[model samples]
Target chain A: MPRYRAIIAYDGTDFYGWQVQPGKRTVQGELEKAVNQMAKNPEIPIRVQGSGRTDAGVHALGQVVHFDLPYQIPANGVRKGLATMLPFDIGIEQVDIVADDFHAQYSAHTKTYRYQLSNREFRAPFRRNYTGYWPRRLDYDKMAQAIPDYLGEHDWISFAASGFQAKTTVRTVTDVKISQEPATQEITFEFTGTGFLYNQIRIMVGVLLEIGMGTRPVDDIPRLLAAKDRQQARLTAPASGLYLKSVDY
Target chain B: MPRYRAIIAYDGTDFYGWQVQPGKRTVQGELEKAVNQMAKNPEIPIRVQGSGRTDAGVHALGQVVHFDLPYQIPANGVRKGLATMLPFDIGIEQVDIVADDFHAQYSAHTKTYRYQLSNREFRAPFRRNYTGYWPRRLDYDKMAQAIPDYLGEHDWISFAASGFQAKTTVRTVTDVKISQEPATQEITFEFTGTGFLYNQIRIMVGVLLEIGMGTRPVDDIPRLLAAKDRQQARLTAPASGLYLKSVDY
Candidate 1:
């Protein structure tokens, strides 16, 4: 058997999420089905493990996954074959045969996530599936000033949503940045970290947006982190705007 | 009665076309429905007349239309009401009341159309709805060199598609430009003219792409125009990549 690792992209508008569930369409389920068809073995089924799960309607640009195949095939062949079998919304960007001990989930060193905001007065029809809408003026300087506080290692319990059973809340964030396009008024938030807890990025975005909206103080990020209370971050940004930008091993 | 002119945008993937057909979803049909709902008058049904028809799967950024209502209403109110009633794929960008002589189709003016091509080794899932796929390298300079031949008044019979009733084949092309985005490998061709025959822009794009692909000569534009034959311009670009960019009154 040969273990193959692949990087993929998806629209995520129609997918339930990245994980497989009975009677629910997901990225993993669709990819596994394609892989099984290519394997053409009824006795042995192939299972794929993703680096992490992206919630419903969250897109990905370079999601990594590892799976074992019964037969050895060239990486390019596997990429072309899987692409032919997969739906139009999911794309296989790259594939490589990896060592038997390599794992997609545990071996990942860092992950970069991005959140997009369409800060316009009206919702654009073509951008509905890709960006979150914020129909108000945002103080860009205030948001930028608040972003640095999120860096370094901290217990991010305040930003994590309920129901995720993580071993520990301590996570190291390596970098954070925010940029805005003057022509479109689209704001983007980028974060790179060792790992993120469930809904942490979205909850953090909610607080940052509040600060930009002038409803919350500029120094709210440190206070929220110190409180370590999920209730402190009252908003969780919509999943449509979130994207897993890349994973690095 | 108040006559209003509105600039609209649409995804156009699900629409049959810009024109209304029986039992078919269309941009015009949807706009009419919304206008009628707002008018709330059975004696008179409001009809929207677009500046021109965009084929199925052809998007628009600033498509202009004009319609009359039974009662007087503020321009902003009409824009907001119609936007609320229309589907997410179609958008009302700007609306203004105009004089009775103002017309969407017959008004004296210019129209701009743009075609987008995703020139890459693989088709991006997210760009499927908006860009035409061309999985090959293109010579940008060659395409740009051929563009100037398209300017000035000429008999554009070679570029026009069949089945259109036009009084004359003579048309003046005011401007033509080709631009490429290095980061995304997306190429855009924009054309501005007094008017265009049915399927003219798509055929023009086809010829330009052939030039870029090295299949046709860079100086082929003049010969094709002189030939005055549609078959000489055999390639018609996909409708998904075409956009009615704007209209000038």
Candidate 2:
């Protein structure tokens, strides 16, 4: 048996998420089905592991995953087989044979996620699926000033969803970059961290948006962190605007 | 009756074309339906006139259209009303009251059409609907060199579709601009002409693509034009890559 790693990209509009739900269309489920059908023995089951589970409607540009095969197949052959079997919305960007010790989930050192905001009065028909539409104007300078509060190690329980089952919410965020395209009125927030609690990125984006809109002050981030209650950050940005940008090991 | 002019935008993936055909979804059909439903009296009909008919699966960024209404409605009111009645894929970018003599199709002085080509090994899922994917690399310098042959007035009959019903095949191309984004391997061809024959832009794009791919010599354009036979330029690029960029009155 050999272990193979791959980088994947997907539109995520029609998928439930990266996890395999029993009766729903999901990225993991589709990938596994394609691999099994391509394998010589149909009865032998193969499991695919992702770096992390992206919520429903969350896209991915470089999502990393790993799987073991009963027999050795060239990485390019596996890529071609999956490309032929999978739907057009999903793409395998790169495939490589990795060391036996490599694990998609446990071996990951850091991850980067991006949230896209379309701050325009009217949403373009073509961008509806990829951006979160915010008709109101935002204050970019204020948002930038507040982003540093999220840096370093902190308990982000307030930003975690109520259903999140992570044992600890303390995580170290390495970097936060905010960029705006004035011509298109699009704001993109990139966060790189060791890991994130479920729904943490969306909740953080929601709060930052409120700050940018002047509904909340910059100092409110520290207060929310101190509260450590999910109710402190009430709004959770929609999953459509979120993307798993990359995973580093 | 008052005449209203509007700049329209739409994602043409789900549309049959800009023409109204029974039992088929079309941009013109949807516009008429929205306008008539918003009218005080639905029994009295109103017709929407487009600058020209776009082929099926072709998109528009600034398509121009005009319609006459029995009563005057504020431009903002009309825009809001149509926004509610129309589907998400369609949008009225701007609306204004125009003189009674203005006609969408006849009053246009120049029309600009854009063709987007994605020259990439693998198509990104996000751009599937907006670009024509070409897996092979294109020589931008060769394509640029061949564009000058399309300038000025010429008989473009060879590029016109077989069923074209236009009275004359001689049309003047005012300008042609070819630009490539090296990072994304996307090339955009913008053509501003007095008018275009039926299927002219698509056919021109197809011929230009061949020239870029080195299958046809740069001088082949003049030969094809002199031939005056449609078979000389056989390929018609897919409608998905074409856009009605703008119409100037």
Candidate 3:
């Protein structure tokens, strides 16, 4: 069997999640269906593996995936085949033939995630679907001062959601960046790390937003980390603002 | 009666156009519905008049409209009231009480329309609704050099769509501007004119796009204008990429 790798992007507003569920519309399910229809034998099932699962309403700019085909087909051919079959919300950004040893999840070295915030008095209707609307003015400097606390290796148990089933909560966060576009009144937070527990990014964003709004002190990140309790960070930002930006292998 | 002027914006994907027709969804219809609901009396009808009628699938960033209310209401109150009643795709950017004599259609001086082109080999699904996908590389210099031909007052019959009902095609085009965002591979064209005939902007954009793609010569603009026939400029661009950007009083 020939192996192929693809970089995918999707507007997750209409999808249940990245994983396949019975009678539900999902990114993985749509990808698999498209692949099966394009396969040499439509009756045979084909499995599509993703780098990680994104929750419902979470978008992706460069999600990586891999799968095997029973017969040979050019990478561009696969892309065109899927492009016509898949829904408009999901797109194949890039496709290439890879070695059999390559794995979408195991071979990943790091991943980057981004969360978008629209900080304005009135949320623009066009942007409501792509950003988390925060009507209050935020202290950008205060938020910047607290971002450094998230750097380095730490047990992110407090940041993870209650239903997270990961065996270990320790993850090495390599970088954190926050950028504000004053013209558009948009704030974007970028996080790069070896891995993240389920819902960790959203929780961190929620706490950071609280700090920016002066509801919490800038030093609360360390306190929450030390507590190692999920209740310490109460708010989980909405999934609409989260994006699986990119993955490294 | 108190007259109110408003700057409206909307994503026109689901709208039939700016005019109201029986059994069809229109921007005018939605605005009227919202205003009528907000009015002091629910049974009485409210008429919303736009500066001009935008073709179906055309969007707007700063469309101007006015309506008379049987009772006086604060500008902010009307905004707030309509905000809850209007659908998410349409929004009011500004509202103010105008003189009783002011009219949305007759009081207008100059109008500006913008056309967006996504000049990339592969169309981005996210931008599909907002831009016309032109997959070929265009000569920006040639397009810019030809823009001057469209300046000043002239009969634009060649640029008007078939079955246009305007009494005269002579209109003063004060300015024509073309800008390209290299990073995003997007090109925008803006035209400021005293007024426009039906489908004039979209037809002009279609000819300019053909010129940019090297299918037509840079001097063809003047030749087409001199032809004084709609068939000379036959390509009418899709309404999806057109926007009624602004109107000057």
Q: Which candidate number has the best DockQ?
A: 1
Q: Let me know the DockQ for model 2.
A: 0.57
Worst 10 residues of 3 chain B by lDDT: B37-46
Question: Candidate 1: misplaced stretches above 4 Å?
Answer: A40-42
lDDT of 1 by residue, B1-249 (tens): 789999999998999999999999999999999999988854767789999999899999999999998888999999989888999899899999999989999994899999999998778999989999888788999999999899989998898897777999999999998999989999999999999988999899999989999999999999999998888997998898999999998
**Clashes in predicted model 1:** 0
iRMS value of model 3? 1.6
Model 2 off-target regions past 4 Å? Answer: none
Docking class of 3: medium
lDDT of 2 by residue, A145-172 (tens): 9988899899989989898787788998
Tens-place lDDT per residue, model 1, A1-249, is 899999999999999999999999999999999999988854868898999999889999999999999889999999999988899889899999999998999999999999999898777989888998788889999999999999999999999898878889999999998999989889999999999999999988999999999999999898889999887887888899999999999
DockQ values of all predictions: 0.71, 0.57, 0.51
True contacts kept of each: 0.65, 0.41, 0.35
Docking class of 1: medium
Can you list the residue pairs that collide in candidate 1? none
Clashes of each: 0, 0, 0
Q: Give each model's whole-structure lDDT.
A: 0.92, 0.90, 0.90
Residue A244, model 1: lDDT of 96
